[model samples]
Target: MTATIVVPTLGRPSLGRLLEALGPGLAKHRFELLIVDDRPGDRPPLALPPGIEATVLDGPARGPAAARNTGWRAARHEWIAFLDDDVLPDPDWADRLADDLAEAGEHVGGVQGVLRVPLPADRRPTDWERVTAGLADGAWITADMAYRRAALARCGGFDERLPRAFREDAELAFRVRREGWSLRRGRRRVTHPVRPEGRWVSVRTQRGNADDALLRHLYGPRWRQRLEIPPGRRHRHVAITAALVTAGAAALVAASGRRGWTAVAAGAGLAWAAGTAEFAAARIAPGPRDPSEVATMVATSAVIPPVATVHWLRGWLRRRAAEPLGSQPAGLPPAHRCPAGWAALSRPTASRSVPTRPFASRSAEGSR
Candidate 1:
């Protein structure tokens, strides 16, 4: 199978590591490499081994989703293998990818490569490390997934509006499976190293709350259940934020000698503190008990709920204003219904009907 390897880079230092690991594969295979520079400006100068054919293109910098879309659209081969700049491919990646694609049938539209995150075994992982390790269990992440070019065309690639790497992959996969195509897990495995990040990385990730609104706008509120992800405590976070805010306001009113407000404040304050303490304990228990670590956790725990709540609310309100419920985004294909036998997905009524033009046909037209 002729394949093009597409990688999206944000000018990461790890890009060099990934390229060095793929040197052998590049030497042995006639694969084309499409390196999309998501950073704004002129084309980037990426060095590679002799005799390798590679092209670099500028990405919209909307996000990784958009970058991958640019990379795959510019690809020439029938199969597109997407690798993130930070991932390390196995030495036999070429052979394994060939083997994975060789076995795909007409019904198989994509093959997801295995992702292995190597965590330090000596000590209990930090909250950030544990969160990063979740990628190992994450399905269909482009970190090492390969797609049939036709499948990508059918799915209209990915939703470029999802301006983050989070949930965008799942959103695309959710759409693809609706087209009556199956995505199989492939044998190829890549190592996704956990690079050091700031203590507040977890807090910053709440930004995906806005992206979640897009997913709900496209799929509906039951989207998580559709994807089989466990129900998150976002509502509880909102409740916690509300309780804390209400408590503070009531405490101020009570200071004005309002006895009724004093009672309300006391109850709200207890609930808020309880919620915060529970959150802090969960994070603190698994983390290294250093002073900075403890302080960071304490500070972030108080802040995350309100911040996450605000982002979620902003995303929800933004969607409600921009599009009504049950309406699909303009220029985008409607979500495809899962084929019968997917008992779990059978309930999303919106996805039950196929779009007017076949997803592949519409996608091809869109590309032109």
Candidate 2:
């Protein structure tokens, strides 16, 4: 069985490593490789290895969701397998992938490969390590997932409105299953190494709260239960933000000599402090708790609540009029015409080639 491997990339340095590791696995299978470059501006041309042949396509720089849609729709095979730019596929990945597809029943629409993240052995993991490790348990992460070409064509690829990598895969999985397709786990494995991050990595992740808000808007509050997602600390974040806001407002009122405002401000401040402390303790307890790690945890614990709350509200407001998954027509965005060079580029070549042709229309109704 042949499959198409689609990888969406921001042109990270790890792209070369992934390609190098992935090449050997494909030796035993008939697979096409498509790399969707999501970078907005011009850069150096991608350095292709000598033996591996890959087609390079331009992404709209919207996000991975848009890039992935650009990919599977352009594929020539029955199954489209997605791998992140950073993941290292096992040497037998393609063999296992073929077996996985061969065993899939007609009703099965998708297969998920196992993702193993490597952590530090000697020291306790940092907060970021723990967060990256969570991908191992994540549902339909697209870190290493394969979907039937027919299933993608039927369910509309992915919601481009989700501007981040977070939740888009699960959201699409929901739509796929809602369309009467079952998803199962596969034996193929990929190693996801924890990449280095800035000190504010945890803070940056709170932006996903906006997507969470979008999910809530699309699926209602019970979306988490339906998606089999565990209840998160969003409720606590909301309470903490409320307490902090109330404390500041009450303090200002107390300065104006309002009766009992000082007590109210004191009470609100105490609530915020207690909530922040508990959150920090929970995070710090499992981590290495080095001075820098503890400081990051404490500082971010204080900042995360208000940031998460604000993003959640922003998403809630932004998608207030959005329809749920199946309420509208869904499928890969339609194309007007293929670029002139597509036919020639689609053919396999002995030498390296990059196809710089636009495939799909940017304007599609209800794709969000």
Candidate 3:
């Protein structure tokens, strides 16, 4: 089977390492390579190996979803395999990928590659490292996923409106299954290493709450249930944010000499403190808990709730009247309808089952 490898990049230094890691696959496989650059303006040329050819296209810089759409749409083969620029594919990736494609039944529209994240052996991982490691148990993440060209075209590719890598892949998977195509877990494996980032990375990640809100708009409030995604901390964030807002409001009222406002302010302030402390402890508990890590956790824990709640509200208000991308499929249910050829795909064999551990769905911006 012929394939095209599509990688969306932001011109990070990891791009070079990723290309080098693909050498073994390129040497043995006949698939084409397409690199979609999501950066703007003049960029340095990529160093290529001898006897290898690749196509580099300019991306819209919208996000990984848009960039991936650009890559697969321009692909020359029936199968388009997506890989993050930071992941290292196993040396036998090409062979395993080919086997996987060959094994895909006629009704199978997509295949997900297994992801393995390497964490520190001697010490507990930091919060960012733990977040990055979530890809290992994530289902249908574009970190290492492939789709048949026909399936992608039928689903209209990814929802570019997502504006980020978050949830877009899983959303597409649902749409594909809703269209009567089955998705399978492939044997190919990729290693996702944790990339270093600033101390405030957790605060930055709270922005995904906005994407979650948009998803809720598109798929309805039960989107998480329909998509089989576990619940997030959105509820807690909302409550914490409410406490903070109440504290500030009541404090202002007390400063204005309102008699009962002082009690309200004190109560709200204590609630906020308690919520923040719990959040910080939860994060710091499983971590290495060094002085710096603890301090970062405490600071970001205090800041994340309000930021997340703001993003969530902004997303909801922005897409308040937006319609779903399309009509829902009519049958047993939208996402659970198994067509003729999907019985086996739905209940994967023991060897094929995706990992059962809880995982965070994320992107390069925050380790998705």
Please report the candidate that would top lDDT against the real structure. Answer: 2
User: Candidate 3, residues 1-368: lDDT per residue as tens digits?
Assistant: 88999988887767767777777777678788888777756655443333345777777778998888888877777789999998988888889999999999878889999999999999999999999998899889999999887676655678877887688888888888877788999999999989889999888877788888888988887999877677888889889999999999999999999899999999999999999999999999999999999999999999999999999999888878876565333343333333423332332122121122111221223211
If the candidates were sorted by their lDDT against the true structure, best first, what order would they fall in?
2, 3, 1
Off by over 4 Å in 2: 327-368
lDDT of 2 by residue, 201-270 (tens): 8889999999998898888779998776768999999999999999999999999988999999999999
Model 3 deviation from the true structure expressed as Cα RMSD, one decimal place: 9.1
TM-score of each: 0.84, 0.89, 0.87
How much does candidate 1 score in TM-score? 0.84
Error of 2 at 206 (Å): 0.8
- Location of the lowest summed lDDT over 10 successive residues in candidate 3: 353-362
Q: State the lDDT at 146 in candidate 3.
A: 95
Candidate 1 residue pairs in backbone clash: 154-360, 337-351
By TM-score, rank the candidates, best first: 2, 3, 1
Candidate 2 local accuracy as lDDT? 0.83
Best candidate according to TM-score: 2
